[model samples]
Target chain A: MRGSKAVVGVYSYLDDLLKGIADIRSADLDYKVYSPAYRHEIEEATLPGKSSVRRFTLTGGIIGCTFGWTLAILCSLDWPLRVSAKDIVSPPGFFVIGYECTILFGALATLGSLLLYCGLPNFLRKVGYDPRFSRDKFGLVVGCDGHNLEDVKGRLMKSGADEVNVTEGI
Target chain B: MSKQSEKKEVSYAMVNDLVLRMLEPPGAGWWVLLLTCITLLSWGAVSFAYQLWAGYGMAGNAHPIGWGTYITNFVFWVGIAHSGTLISAVLYLFRAKFRMPIYRLAEAMTVFAVMTAGLFPLIHVGRPWMALWLMPYPNERALWPNFRSPLLWDVFAVSTYFTVSAVFFFVGLVPDIAAARDRAKTFFRKMLYGVASLGWTGNNTQWKHFIAAYLLFAGLATPLVVSVHSVVSWDFAMSIVPGWHATIFPPYFVAGAIFSGVAMVMTLIIPLRKVFKLEPLIREEHFDAMSKLILLTSSIVAYAYITEFYVAWYSNNMFERFQFWFRPFGEFAVAFWGMAFCNCIAPLALWYGPLRRNIAFLFVLSIIINIGMWLERFNIIFTSLAREYIPAAWGSYNFSWVEIGITFGAFGWFGMWMTLFIKFFPAVAITEIKEILPPPVRNKESLQGHH
Candidate 1:
């Protein structure tokens, strides 16, 4: 992966980092933020749209419930036992299996969506990632062509970035 | 870059260092604990092998008391598993910030306890190879497991619980694993942490999806906390046996489960906090909050007991009344009273602030509660079955050496897994603690409009 962005600013304080990102945003410079922790401020600033993971959860739950009911009812019909003079299609017993499957499938779907949305299991590490981004430092990777590289770096530095490193790609 | 004019009191850098330090290789004491657990676990494996060779007859189970110590231990461990989901998932949904430090351990306990609990039914069945028949797969024999049986429901419930809990535990560990990956000093360590972390970058987009998925899991697991134990309870309640067939069993079992589970967590965290020196993260305030939860659950369990006895008397059923009466005054009366005293009377100590805060007192009390909870299952299973409808078929069961060894082995199994987990994974949620800490103050001029 070639890094097109030149400036990577690390900040000790989240507010300073957010301010720096906001200043860069004003210049319409494309950037991505990284933090050691999940900060609501960062999410609100960078990715404000609603997540789509819940749709997968709902779809998975529906399929699970239907499958559970179908399996129970079909298995009983196949056996065709007249135990205790009760109906072969026992809704009560089927509901238990269905309830469990709903949770099982819903949880699995959530995991699937998490992996898909997060772009995980990428054996190859992305380029231009700072090690300290996973520790205390919050990093803002700004994308800039050579014409605006110095301009973006100066803005982040003036916005109180602890360190500003100019990388070639991203 | 120029340094800030004033020094920041605390920084995320310090938090990362303290939390990640726990993931280092074990000390001498941890190794000793692991070896002891492994030895005990090996003894348990030997006992299981013997049981396999000797058949179910080797267990103390007999005609009337068909279910014995194995089932008792099964129920106890299942109950012990509940508090983890309760603390991790349920408490998370409720927005309990205090759960941050200890929830990971509780979730780990849930997974391990369920794994241990899964072994019991197979062990109890004697024919371990035939246990595969419990699965719902299509077979050439044209036979299906009895869906009407709560036992079958248990097969589904417990397995689902294990899967969900394990996934939840791993999902929560991702950021921590990434943190570990960054700090890895060796190539082997980096590669291991790298795979475990799955290339987590902690970017804004990933956090958005991560939080969403995590919340969904919390929501999914919360129902499981209620349904799994309720299903376990139905294994008894759905039966025709006196003292077992009660509508109240679901809530009763659920409360008892949380009661025992919380005690187990206390038992674990007290020793862990001391050994790991995690006082700042797992403070006295956390214990105070947890003890109060224990008190609440204990009271519920106590109320369930009284209501159970009252219902037995009011029903005017001779068998039910006898079963209830026999519990406190019959052959298992000692166990019955011990259970009541330990589960109901012992947790009352937490109501006092001094006792709740007293580490030694709480630790001992937690152990006592575990014992009581175990006895509670024993009394419930044995007394009712021994003196059932047929007096001629009445019999008593003694815990044979096999069952005793297996029980000890289960503990060893749980302990060994946990010992390794603490050494490898972040014992506490490092990413979460960073979020919980107040962010550093910034200059008003630079941050004025953003806030």
Candidate 2:
């Protein structure tokens, strides 16, 4: 397991590193990119698409609206107590509750979907992580066979990686 | 690649060093402050316990003036909570780059202030255990909280605001927590950071989802910044009380909330930046920008004050007119005049550029405005209820020592939480600042030379 994956490149500048990723993409090497901050360059180079998180927000809002209206209406109907001659089920008043629920559920759903998508709360520490990536440095973990380890290391070094770490056996 | 700005260069290591330094153990001075807050908080707890034992009569509540200092404190703290969302969500949506350094503290303040505000209603209700009745959960009684009631609306609005804001705050912390985790030397610190970080790897995939989720939350929270305070306003406006029942309550409350919120932010951050040596990160420009907002909102609040009186006179409603007149010349004249001076007049100083830039002036002004905002609430609650429609029911209410102690305790509680938060978590958003920074200087030469 330890002899499988090969090199990790720590780049100080995001632009050069992103270009390095573009080069890796052209070569079709399996790789992971890490940065301290979210960068559009990385997004364009790597995960290029509209995030699917929006669907969760939309669906959650719909569910929330339905839940809000249904709950308010059902509760009113259950009691059937007419207050101040108003109707039992007041849609106008319930709209406030519905609006609040929409935001509440939508935010919750967004957070839930985010955690699900990111595979977060993972207690186990995965290998091939460089501590410097959490600081100023950008990191690339390129998966390589024994034969391509040297080639991958050289490619990352040539692309202006400040330092490259070689790890063996996954 | 986007062209880098030729601004003062900041490296990621510099940010890490500056922010993570806050996570170090507190000094003797910090311990002294924490101890004082804890002492005050304990006194507040004792006061509350006494209230629980002695009953609501311990506070100043009688015939016409059923609502008193408790309600005033509730509204004040809620108003204080509003600025955080405005700075964090509204400013974020507008792409205010300066919000990066200070928004984290403001957001934390919002959460803690709301927590303090939430306690008031529970205490006001007297039977704290039965306060859960405000919730719409299914029960054997087959009764639901009255949705038509503004108080019930407040229940949903405030709770929703709290939940969303807390989640938003924590979401922003994920990356910073990971940074802290990597830098942790002690095993205990490492374990704590590791769990809190939620296995954040800062990979492109995580960043993508994080940003998307953050944007959605910001959008969701933006409306809440308006709605929460609006619903809180309706608690007064929906009533038939003269000063309380105004059509202008919603926007007026929103503006005042933001006004007081910014003032409170200034109150907290002025000292914090000095203590943490975050002057570089939280620049003078940020203070200038915030002061401008404070000025804008204060003007709106001042306008609301005038409009309230104008509408009262224009309507030719005797009670409304009397209420407005009574505010300035009546029993609570001192409070009304003080509020006007502090809220309306004091903020006028910011009109001068030098005053806004002067940290001493801004700090003093912020304290004065906070006092003015509190008085504003006090005047509204006390004056309106004291002299309502029925003359026979007219009564004056005074603050009992118990209520005063409890209010002080709320402040202590809020301060204590914030002090602890600053110690454990990065008060500033590390990742956000990194995003806005010019590309690292050392890295730039190496990369450009290669190209």
Candidate 3:
């Protein structure tokens, strides 16, 4: 967002994309990488930390579990209606409901965390996006000052960018 | 692995095209099939309306057989939903590569099948409008649903299963939907895919969270899948009725559910693959793997069948023994025998390696397995209730035309969702399929040049 111009590198091969990412990192340019599919090699190259989505899942599951048991136990005790001479508060039966809630809440939370972290429905800014990136291409987008834009473009091309485009204001 | 990719010769762009092409304007056949589904769904709707008007007696539920075809269909559809989760979530945890192409379809099946299954309990209750009372919300009467009852457990389990599976299905669809959005030419399609894809760009951050969350969904779903069917089984097993009360019912029902579900998957995929010309993606190897699964589950089901009979005899309980005896020898012997043939005997043909890979044989066998699974449920529900402890209390369920129409209509309901899904969304996972393909890489010379 600080830069007035950005350099975009379109890559057909993953190897070239990785090389470009390495170059941009060395040059200390803020950049983003895009791919047609998830790849471990890209993750290894980009070095984004482990996603925190798991924390959301764990927290959601625990809350769901607690809520499930409380609801079931409280509802059972409220009436104190005994059937089949079973216990007044049945953990065994309630466990089924609790287990299901754990999954339901866990999954919904994961989705919420994914959307929040990924900045989805991002209609505000779509700079440097290419349709081919969703099909077969890898894209490296580097934001830089207008004066340094040529240097960034040169570095990307040297690292093996198939095509490079420089646009004003990313 | 590189050599394998070289031999197969598929690329990322080709994968996108292959799957996205399925979302194109439908052909005559698709329209014809869609029309057929609507016609059948109308039949089911009219039947249900008549049942509502005429009273619960319009169907077969009478005397001891209070639960009839509606309950049977409920179990059947729920069982059918099991395979979707098994393939989509369980196989994913195993990192089974063969599931890459077919799991999307199976996951969709799981969602739609559960939607179809959720309707039955309402239909069975005779007062579909008052179904909300089953929920534990605070009421004016201050009456809470019985927490210990297996029926109450079912409301929680099945609803949770549907929610989780639908979320899993949609999460997997997001990236593929983005791919479709890129290829879409029409304005309405543009907005639809734009919103549905949630503006996915498959960037590093998006893929990072996406992969992490997807793994967690799979992990959570795997246990839930097993538990959901077990809860469904407990609705019968918790009852004191001789044949219904058994510890083995959980595993028995789970295996049978997967067996029938995988067959249902085959029943769907064979025709879909042919029509879409997805032979290279959904290869014989996938079907071979699916058939082996059917074989494994069929063996378990057959063993459970034997165990049911053995336990009945070994327990020295005459009621249990009589229920087991009457299943194959009494008035409903045809259903029991038919289930035995379809569930136990029919899948034995898959033992042959050649037949396991044969598409036509698998399709026919899948339909037979589905029918057999349905009959298996029918036998369990009808036979146990028909002759309980006292002979004087014995009864038979009368199958009315309404029941038959509604049963066929459930298929229409399921089929209608599937038909519309295939047209609007990417029925196959474009991104996952591309993930398995060789990454687009420059020649060795180019890599050395970069270094």
Candidate 4:
């Protein structure tokens, strides 16, 4: 293990390439996980061990709906107009607004919540390199600047990664 | 994926029998075709023609009660429509699996209910020809529509809701339409589902795009539904009559909408599910889950009812105070308590888990809820107005037979739409149900070697 920086073009790996790498304290390995149109790597490196940005719970959706409804109601109160001889604050009359607000607020809030939580941008940019990953291959690309780059690559090969590749990021 | 598939066993046969039953000719329960729906529907329409030819007097508009039975039915129908979106988009987004059997039909209900609702305002208008004024158009008249007007809001809310839900419903139906497309041998059927499916091929890419678009529409629509009903609630809440003004009306009305809607869905779906042999697919489990929701919504509505009365009492305002007290003890006390029995008291039947699970009990409860929701609307609209701001303006609202005709006509319109949908499309989304089936039940033989 020696050197400042190096990139290994990991075309493929044996199933047990890292099975024999033993008695090492630790290694600093920077892995970038990418998937093509069809399949992406499992992205173990990117997944937060403690906390994650990607969440699918509906609580966020519900809160957003409720909040949106509350906001719409808050906005509607600006001018409580009289209609057809009835006072503006009647509870039965508010039924229409409440109903409308609930539907609008709940639905819009859910949409807004989903967009925020899903981490979706206007566009998904594509990164190049990795053909076998398209056909059920988990690509593990490790960027390291030490003499043990090969050793790190070897470790991933043993961790059930069918192919290992080093690709340039956009 | 394999483990997920292995997690639960769902005998597809449980639902298969339903499809097979639907495939069979409907049995000898001809009363549904003759006496109940058809008779009621035509009777209503024929009555409506007379209403239009004559005047608003047939339905008992009288002098004080400008709005009568038609408005009550309008609000009632609007309330009845909430469960469709609640089940299809809202519950689906929440991943409530029990919603599967009822989603399509519920969505159909939303569309039909809105259709029926849109009719009443027109019928109630003195000059139906002027209904075009409801539209925001660049006409010669410089007058602007009062945006603050809840009636205008209904125009926006109901139209938006109906349009969006129809799209959402159709989008979800695409895959099923594709399935129907594949299964269909006839020219018209193939053309119908083909165009409806929008050239869908079950490629993963297509499915992804279709799902994404459908999700987007659902997200867009979920709010419109809340907005629609909140607007409806606001129509009442914005009024200053004794019982009409309260802050809780929005949430309370929404709860009632969902409560009543779910009940209506239950009423229609239970019969359809049974007749179509869908008991296995719709399942006791689904009914159990729905019963719990019925209980929850019922509780919220009941809470709203109490909160309303409490606020009226605490406010100590004579007008508001008189509204609540007079409602229970006045000449209309029988009707007031009747509303309570239908909306509030009867739902307690769901408190027992066994009763909630009982299809017959739930069926009866569903009927009661509908009856109660209708009365609740009647009480809200008529009770407050029957006794006017001045004792001189005080007068009772009564529905003449002509008024009754338009009311029933509205129901006929709703049922006709539903009947048409059933004749054309499969009521259940077969593929979606298959997707949600627990793995073992999905692949019945997949568990042989697992120790």
Best by TM-score: 3
Q: Sort by lDDT, best first: what order?
A: 3, 2, 1, 4
**Residue B59 shift from truth in candidate 4, angstroms:** 2.1
Give the DockQ of candidate 3. Answer: 0.72
Q: Each candidate's lDDT (Cα)?
A: 0.88, 0.89, 0.91, 0.63
Per-residue lDDT of candidate 1, residues B1-451 (tens digit):
2223212333677777877888776689998999999999998999999988888787888878888888998999999999999999999989998898899899999999998988898899899799999987899999877787799999989999999999999999999999999998878888889999999988888899999899999999999999999999999999889999999999999999999999999999899988877776777778888899999999999999999999999999999999998999998899999999999988887888988778888899999999999999998899989989877877887778988899999999999998888888887888887877766547556445545
Error of 1 at B158 (Å): 0.9
Kindly report which residue stretches of model 4 are placed more than 4 angstroms away from their true locations once superposed: A1-170, B1-36, B438-451
* TM match of model 2 to true structure: 0.97
Interface RMSD after interface superposition, model 3: 2.1
TM-score of each: 0.96, 0.97, 0.98, 0.71
**Residue B258, candidate 4: how far off, in angstroms?**
0.4
Computed on C-alphas against the true complex, the DockQ of each candidate is: 0.72, 0.64, 0.72, 0.04
Model 4 deviation from native, Cα RMSD in Å: 10.6
lDDT of 4 at B342: 81
DockQ versus reference, model 4: 0.04
DockQ-better candidate, 2 vs 3: 3
lDDT (Cα, tens digit) per residue for candidate 4, span A2-116? 2333233232221221221121114545443422111101211233232221122234345544653443344335444555766544555444444544444444444344334
Model 3, range B1-451, lDDT digits (tens) per residue? Answer: 5536643688898888888889999999999999999999999999999999999899998988888999999999999999999999999999999899999999999999999999999999999999999999988997899989999999999999999999999999999999999999999999999999888999888898999999999999999778999999999999999899999999999999999999999999999999998887898889999999999999999999999999999999999999999999999999999999998888999899999999999999999999999999999999999999988999998899998999999999999999999999998888888877767788655444423
Q: Write the candidate numbers in order of decreasing TM-score.
A: 3, 2, 1, 4
